[model samples]
Target: MSLEAYIWCAALKLDVCNGTPFRVLLCLADRADSLGYGAYPHVSTMAEQLGCSDRTVQRAIRDLTAAGLIREGDQRYVQHLDSRYRPTVYDVLTTALVTLESRGDNRVTPNRSRGDKKRHPGVTSAVALRTVQEPTYQDSSRELTLVTAQEVEEDQ
Candidate 1:
């Protein structure tokens, strides 16, 4: 998986807060080249990796396409004696394309639209939380206190 692509997708708020779409996007992004285009895999493969149904993968693809995060490219077709199957090709929208289309300003800057501000105003970065201690009963009451690395550092 491309950590940079995942981070870019998350930071840019390109997806609706759904894990499936993000996961599908990540799969495509992982295979994408520098131009943000990649060979499309079968829906069954994506569903297997994401642990979702084929319909769910299709829905996520539709959503991403509608959101302009990805564009359908040339399709590959295999012709058999009695039948032919065509697989879709997906092209992830580059940062430049995303900025140009979504931002409404042809500038290659971060999108800070009102919707983004409303959804993630206070989120500056993602920090992983490690449990220092498990919850326990004290004085016949149960209380859970979660501490993060930032908190530990601050305490020190």
Candidate 2:
């Protein structure tokens, strides 16, 4: 587990994530390898670590999976003389962190317009102002360019 990865996970927006799911995500991030592969831990163990019920942990796993932040990986089944069990491996999608970092300046803000029927009532939206400037790179030597969501949509 990289300290930088854990820090990145901790800095995610809480408005879009419930407490349990966010804690579960942090736990997985703590065990992730350089490639974002996390070792499978028993549900009971995870529950203990997160200080929650096993059912809560299960729900968190479901939420993370549904949100596309984590994906099920390989499974290992252990067969004993009288019992069998399979442990689920997970791959945390680190690309989500990159996307989030790139959109750090863009956050959900309340839309006070009365005629904005395209948006739900009392709901907030993240709308980045369009710009025609060239993409900015954090590292000039690496040639890594940050593209906004609107830019990707425009390209498509």
Candidate 3:
């Protein structure tokens, strides 16, 4: 059980994953180890826990694997009178960087007339104005280009 893995899964953007697939990922993350590996739960168990059908759980797993967000580990096999394949272990892959949108900036502003001074809004207009006027920042993929001023300063 790695808290870090769970937090990372929770912070993922909706564009990356949402709905059933997102829930399935979060469940795997909860059972993951410190290095974001070792999540082996039966499909039936996951279905029961998530209040969905086993087929639904399996579909979610397949979708997640297809998206490269998870990878199947060694297959578990059972030996005895049952002699059946056990639940498969999975590893959560976080190769893609996800950026979360701030709650303050996501709010939809109400439309107002140009000369409408009747609204006595408290700081909402100011925040919306600032957000509208703020310059868009593009993240560079170059390794040598620092994205923030707080990062390591290179000597000339």
Candidate 4:
């Protein structure tokens, strides 16, 4: 779906709450689209539409970047809008995630079992916690603690 449409649908379906900015963004972005513009908004423009200050827009941009929903690049990124890129960002991201998960590295994938594991050499069980301790309760009140190599060094 178009970014603007996606945002609008999400905002409307979610009913503001945390979606107000995205709703505003979608509205402004749609307006920009109608103007025959591929305008990558400066924070001020975004803020004006969202009825927020520039800082708020900036924060949203930063959050989007951190979440990998948006990215920055030199002129090349703009020239090849990710929306137009073959093997779009979403495809590449999901493929990469799948690759890692098949190798038993991603924490978010399920359907992993011994048969699946045998397919990949050197893959460890995802459920296996590489912890150093076996829990031993000191008293009725159980307090969990991770044993570390440091304690051995201190003893020596």
lDDT of each: 0.66, 0.68, 0.71, 0.43
Model 2, global lDDT: 0.68
**10 residues in a row with least lDDT, candidate 3:** 96-105
Q: For candidate 4, lDDT tens digit of each residue in 1-156?
A: 245434433444333324544543453345332211232544566577678887776666555445443344223224444554322111111223335547886341122343453544455555254544666766468577877899978988
Root-mean-square deviation (CA) per prediction:
17.2, 18.8, 19.0, 17.7
Q: Tell me, by lDDT, which candidate is best.
A: 3
**Per-residue CA lDDT of candidate 2, range 27-95, in tens?**
877876544554466778889998889999999999999988788854422222223445577766676
lDDT of 1 by residue, 1-156 (tens): 455555556665533535788888888877655446543667889899989899999999998888778898534322212234455778778684465557675322223244554434645333223335556666556577999999999999
Question: In terms of TM-score, how similar is model 2 to the real structure?
Answer: 0.52
All candidates: TM-score: 0.50, 0.52, 0.55, 0.33
In the range 1-156, model 3's lDDT, one tens digit per residue, is 778778888898999989999999988888876545668777888899999999999999999999888897534322222437467878777432121122232312123234546465455776756765665556645466446555545431
Lowest lDDT 10-mer window, candidate 2?
74-83
Model 1 lDDT, full chain set: 0.66
Show where candidate 2 strays beyond 4 Å: 76-85, 96-156
Clashing residue pairs found in predicted model 1:
none
**Which pairs clash in the backbone of model 4?**
none
- Given candidate 3, what's the lDDT at residue 46? 84
